[model samples]
Target: MGKLYVVGIGPGGFEHMTFKAKKAIEESDVIVGYTKYIDFIEPLIKDKEVLSTGMKSEVERAEKALELAKDKVVSIISTGDAGIYGMAGLILELKKDEEVEVIPGITASSSAASILGSPLMHDNCNISLSDLMTPYDLIKKRVELATQGDFIISLYNPRSHGRPHYLKECIDIIKKYRKGDTPIGVVKNALRDGQEVTLTTLENFDDTIVDMFSIVIIGNSGSYIKDGMFITPRGYKL
Candidate 1:
C-alpha cells in the first residue's frame, strides 16, 4: 500500500512550515499543487519531481495526486492548513484504497494574527470571500451572522480583482453591528516576501491595498489596539 500525504505548507515561507509537514513532503516521491503555492516551496522541493497545475485545476490536481499515490508516496501541498480551502478534501473524496494522511500547518489566519498581536484570543470565525465554489449570498449571510455574534473574523480570500467589491460589501454589513472604529488588521503575503501588516479602523480601511494574498482580521467589540498591536481580550478579569 502506498501513502498519500496531504500537507499544508503554511503561509508562503518555509519558516512557517511545521516539521511534520516538511517531513511528509520530503519523504514523498512526488509533489503536486497549484503553481503559485508550489513556487513558495521551491527551495525545499529542489531535486524532487513535482507536478504543477494552474488555477481552477484543483480537480485535476487531486485526481492526479491520488492516481500517483496508488503505487508510490505522493504529496499534495497547499498553503495554510490543507483542510482549510486546501486540497485535502478533494483528494480524500477522490481517494480510494489509499492510505491518506493530512499534516496540518500554521494557518494564515493564526500566523497573520501572530504578526498583528493576539486578535484571536477569544471566540472567532473564519470566512472566505472567494465565492468561486461557494455562493455569494451564503458568504454574505455568514459575514452578517459573524458580525452579529461579535466574533473576531479572520477573513480569507477577502478580495480579488474579479470580485473586488464583495469585501466592501461585507464591511458595510459588519458596520451595522460594529462601530466604525472597530480595529481591522490587514496582512499581505504574511511572512512571505514583501509582507506587510497594517492596523487600521474599519471606517478608514484601505480596500485598494488588499488582494488575493491578503488576510484580514476584524476585531470584535472587545478588541482594541495597544502599542500598535491589535488585541482581543480573552475576558480574563485583571
Candidate 2:
C-alpha cells in the first residue's frame, strides 16, 4: 500500500515552498489539489499525473487522492500549511486508519505578519471570516472572545462577493474590546504576485483593501505602529 503526502505549497509561491514539500511532490506519482493551487507549482509537477478540481470540491479531491494512494504515491496540495485551514484535517478525518504524512508550510498569518513587520510577535489567534463551513454567529462569538482577551487576531477569507458585510461586522465586534487606534495590517497575495501590504489602525481599517486572497491582521492592546511597521511587542525588558 502506497502512502499519501498532504503537502502545503505556502503562499502560492515556489520560493515560499519548503524543501520537504517540494520533495514530496517530486516523489509522488500523482498530484492533486484545487485548480489554482495546482497552478502554483506547475513547474514541479510537469511530468506527473495531475488531478485538479475547481473550488468547493475539496471532498472530491480528498477522496480521489486517497484512492490513488492505494497503489501509487499521491500528494494533495493546499495553498497554506496543510493542517491550518487546509486539506490535512479533512483528509485525516476521512482516513483515520491510514498512515498519512502531513508536511507543514508557512501559513497565511505568518506570511502576512512577515510582510507587515512583526504584528504576530505576541500570542495570536487565527479566525476565518468565511461562514461557508462555520456559522457566522459562532465566528463572531470567537472573535469577540479573542478580542476581549487581547489576542492578536489574523483573519483569513475576510471578505468575498457573497459575504460583503461580514468583515465589517467582525470589525465592529473587535471594536467593542479594542481601541480605535489599535494597529491593523492588511496583506493581499502575501509573498506572491501583485502583493499589497497596508498598515493602518482600527479606525481606518475601512480604507484598506481586502479580498479572498488577503489576510487581515488586527493587533491587540499592546500592538503599535513604529517606523512604518505594524508591530506587537513581546513585552521584552529592553
Candidate 3:
C-alpha cells in the first residue's frame, strides 16, 4: 500500500500554506479535492493527475484519494487545517487498509485573527454556524455557553445563501448574555485575493457583509479596541 497524504493548503494560497503541506503535495503523484479548492493549488501541482468533486461530494473525494493511494502517492487537499472543518476526519473514518498521513495548514481563524490584530490572544473556541450536520438549537446552545464562559469565539461557515439567518440568530443569543458594545471582527476571504477586513461591535455589525468565506471573531468582555485594532487581552496586568 502506498501513502495517502491529507493536506491542508490553507486558504488555497502559497503564503499561508506550511512547508510540510507544500512538500507533501509536491511529493504526491495525484491530487484530489473539491473543485474550488483544487483551483487554489493549481500552480503547485503541475504535471500531476487531479481529481475534483463538487460541494457535497466529500465522501467521493476521500474514496478516490484512497483508491489512488493504493498504487501511488495521493494527496487530498483541504482548505484550512485538515482536522478542523477539513477532510482529515472523514478520510480517517473511511480508511480500512491505507497508510494515511495528515499535513496541517494555517486555519482561517488564525489568519483572520492576525489580520484583525489579536482577537484570539486569550481563551477561545471555534464554532461553525452552518446547521447542515448539527442542529440549530445545539449550535445556539454552544454559542450561549461560549458567551457565558466569556471565551473569545471564532465562527466558521457563518452564513450561506440557504441559511442567511443562522449568524443573526447566534448574535441574538450572544446579545442576551453580552453587552451591546462587545467587539466583533470579521474577515472575508482571509489571506486570499480580494480579502476584506472589518472591525465592528456586536450591535453595529452588518450581517449582510458575511458569507461562507468569512470568519467571524466575537470578543469576550475583556476584549477592547484601541488604535483601530481589535484585541482580547491575555489577562496580564502590565
Q: Please write out the lDDT profile of model 2 over residues 1-238, one tens digit for every residue.
A: 7889999889988889999999999999999999999889999999999999999999999998998888889999998899999999999889955568999999999999998999999999999998989999999999999999999999999999899999999999998989899999999999999998888899988733789999999999999899999988899999
Which whole-number lDDT from 0 to 100 does residue 86 have in model 1?
A: 89
| Model 2: pairs clashing at backbone N, Cα or C within 3 Å | none
What are the per-residue Cα lDDT tens digits for candidate 1 across 52-149?
A: 99999999999888888888898899999999888888978888788899999888899899899999999999999998899999999999999999
TM for every model, in the order presented, reads: 0.98, 0.98, 0.98
Task: Count residue pairs with overlapping backbones in model 2.
Answer: 0
RMSD of each: 0.9, 1.0, 0.8
Poorest 10 consecutive residues of model 1 by lDDT? 87-96
Q: Distance (Å) between predicted and true CA of 47, model 1?
A: 2.1
| Deviation (Å) of 145 in candidate 3 | 0.9
